[model samples]
Target: MERSLAALLVCVFGVTTGEFVLAGILPAVAGDLEVSIPAAGLLVTAYALGMIVGGPLLTAITAGRPRKPLVVGLLAVAVAGNLLSAVAPGYGVLFAARVVTALVTSTFFANAIVIATSAAPAGKQASTVAKLVFGMNLAMILGAPLGTWIGEAFGWRATFGAITACCAVGLLLVARLVPGDQPVTRSRAFGEFTVFRNQDLVLAIAITAVANIGLLMVFTYLAPLLTGPGAFAAAAVAPMLLVYGVGATIGNLIGGRLADRALLPSQLGALAVLVVLLVALWASPHPVVTGLLVFAAGAVGFSVIPGMQTRVLTTAAAAPTLAIAVNASAYQVAAAFAGWLGGRVIAGPGMTSIYLAAALATVLGIGLSAVALRRDRVRVKQSVLR
Candidate 1:
């Protein structure tokens, strides 16, 4: 890995840990803050709203700044935000702090991807992005668990302290390693928005948002699905989620390599397989089968992400940072929508119906990918005639 990429990896790991660690600590947060667990859960919602609304807007606002300093500044703010969370006086204070911290998450991520990809060797951008994505994987696999352990051992506030300390280390690494003279495109804020007018770019962004809904939806409800229909004990939830996370990490790396070789084809295959896995999950065939499929579903589901990000970056190279930030926002939008839709499904049909709904939702992603693939062929043929 490039030195800069490694540094950004640390940054990604830290910021994402902050985002994800709340799940394990929410009950603790509620008890301390004198709020209901569900109310405390709104902190997650606050962060998503921050990422969704803040990412593109903040990236565009900082578009004129030097890349190196921008990332450093963002991470510094994140460190402070986490510290604030650690010492927040009440739920309201903690909520605002989370939003503030989240405001920088997507912008930092967008800049980090651009920095890493810009330094990548030819034809290796997607894989490079995948490497950066390992930070998120590590956040899920290692950081969240460790943070949860710390919270349990100390307090929920201590979890924030640990995350803050990690962000500070990431901040130092980023400043030392990332080049001082990293280039910026320096486009006007409003002008960057014009990239959205490009139909292909819009489609790439939409594909990312649409394709991820089912995966996030199911993941959000994995505990209930596993316990209720899969007939697994509550004790099984943690280990099963661990298996899913491991599969996701492996899939992300493979997907990166596949995307580097053949972007759309790999994405199409992954999505198709994911659709099948979701349908199979709906069957609730057996505990063993369900467990295996959980892992496979995670692998296939996340395998599409690097390609999705690559497609967005490819389509909007002139405004890659803004485009990717918007892409992240779109993903958060999908997550929010997926949660809402999943709730409706749970309320109406049943818990098991989530998988069926998920599979059907993924079919839309397949259609979009197929259409994008066909257009690529048409564009190539036309260029040949010309």
Candidate 2:
């Protein structure tokens, strides 16, 4: 990878750490801010909402700008937001700061991925995108745990302060390293929305939304599930999470390779594995079994992500920036839905229900993938007949 792309990867790691650090340090934030845990939890909701609303909108608005400077500006927003988070005196200020940071985070993801793919050598697009996303997976694997430990050792404010410093470094690296490219063409922001007219691209978006909902539904409540029935010691949670993260990283690389060879089959196979693993996790009570299943779940679930991302790029070849931005927004939409639905399921039906619910969502994603595959076959047939 180029030094510039490596910097972008580190930038992604920082942004993703910021996104998930709140989850690991929620109790500290709640206590420090004098809010209920549930209320403090709304910070996550606020961030996801911002991503859902801001990603496409901001990407469309900046569609014509030079990507390098745009990325630097977005990273500056992240730095400011995190700095505000580090010193916020009330829940409302922190909430607003998180929203602002999330807007920058999502828009940055859209722009960064476009840059990664654009800068990649011929026939290696999926692999480059996977490397970029691997940074996010690394955050889940290590950064969140470290941030949480810092919060416990010092304070939640300290965690945000560290994140702010990280963002500042990322900003400098992006500004100095990423190449500046002039606009190829210019159009109204509304014109970007026209990519939605493509049914294949829309299906790709649905796959992202549904698959992520399923993935996060289980992940958002994973701690309780691990300790509740599995009877694992509290100390074991972090290690188990690491195992899952490792699996996720492996799956991400595998998925990229598979997508290059066989996109449709790779996605189908991954979702199928995910559905089976979710069911297995629900039934297994042993800690070892649970840990193995958790790893497999992460592996299989994430294995399809690159395929879904690349699908949007291929299908919306003419408007990949908007399509990919919409794709990122779809993930945020799924996250919001997963958080709400998982909460309801945990409250009403109990914790195990979260996995079952996620399984159902994955099943839907599988159905959608099947439909997309069928459509591809028919189009191929028509081409041959013509």
Candidate 3:
């Protein structure tokens, strides 16, 4: 990998690690801060809220800036946030620090994606984007776990301190290696909102929001699903989740390859496969079979992401950062909705039905994706006639 891309990948990994590492250390945080676990859990909600609210606004606020400087600056903000988190004197301050960290998270990620994909070799955008996405996959697999370990071994504050150090390394690399030649002199501050008027762009964003809801919901509840319906030992949850992460990593790479060949068709096919796989998880009669199903679900479920993200970037290439930021925000919104919907499903139907509920959500995503593609085709034919 190019050093510049590597730096950006590290930034992606560090920033994402900041987003998720809270899960592993919430108990430590709550106990130290003298707050309840649920209160510390609100730290997660606050970060998500910040991302959903902050990404587009910040992206728009900084439209047309030089990409290199913007991303580096955002990483600097991330460093400050995490440092504040490490030294926060009380829960209120730590909560603020988390929101501050999250506010820059998605926007920084969007800019990095734009930078990386802009520098990609021709016809390799999806594959390149996947490389950046791979950083997030590693965050789930490695960064979060490592940070959790640091928290366990030292203290929760040490986890944030470690994240801060990682972001600082990414910042130094980005400053030294990533090229700053790209500039968006044409991007209007608020005029980028006009991108929203594009039907395909709208659909691309919708596909992201709708399709991933299923997998996110199911994954959110996977531990329970494993120990409950699958009748696995409680100790087995982490290993099974590891199985899913391995599958996700492979799926991300495969999705990148498929998307480079054919973006929408591959996305559609992947979504179909995801729906089938989610539904398929319903029939796991043995532990080994259940593990395999979890892996398949992870693989097929994540295979759609690269295409989805790439479509938004391509559709809004004139000014892709804000669009990408909006797309990120949409995914956050989907995650929140998935949490709510999964809760309802569990309360009403039961834990086993969560899989079916997730499958149904993706089926809705399929419908939206089909509509978006059809609209794009019609627009193309009309313009060709014109």
lDDT of candidate 1 at residue 339, scale 0 to 100: 94
For each candidate, the alpha-carbon lDDT, in order, equals 0.93, 0.86, 0.90
lDDT (Cα, tens digit) per residue for candidate 3, span 283-330: 767888889989998988888888889999989976699999999999
Candidate 3 ranges beyond 4 A from true positions? 379-386
What are the TM-scores, per candidate, against the unseen true structure?
0.99, 0.95, 0.97
Poorest stretch of ten by lDDT in candidate 1: 182-191
After TM-score superposition, the amount by which residue 325's alpha carbon in candidate 2 deviates from its true location, in angstroms, is 2.1
Q: What is the per-residue lDDT of model 2 for residues 131-250, given as tens digits with 9 covering 90 to 100?
A: 888989988888898898888999999999988888888888888888887233466766878878999999999989987788888887788888887688888888888998999999
Clash count in backbone of candidate 3: 0
User: Which pairs clash in model 1?
Assistant: none
Highest lDDT among the candidates is held by which one? 1
Task: List ranges where model 1 is wrong by over 4 Å.
Answer: none
* Candidate 1 vs candidate 2, TM-score winner: 1
Candidate 1 lDDT, tens digit per residue, 72-174?
9999999999999999999999999999999999999999998998888999999998999989999998999999999999999999999999999999999
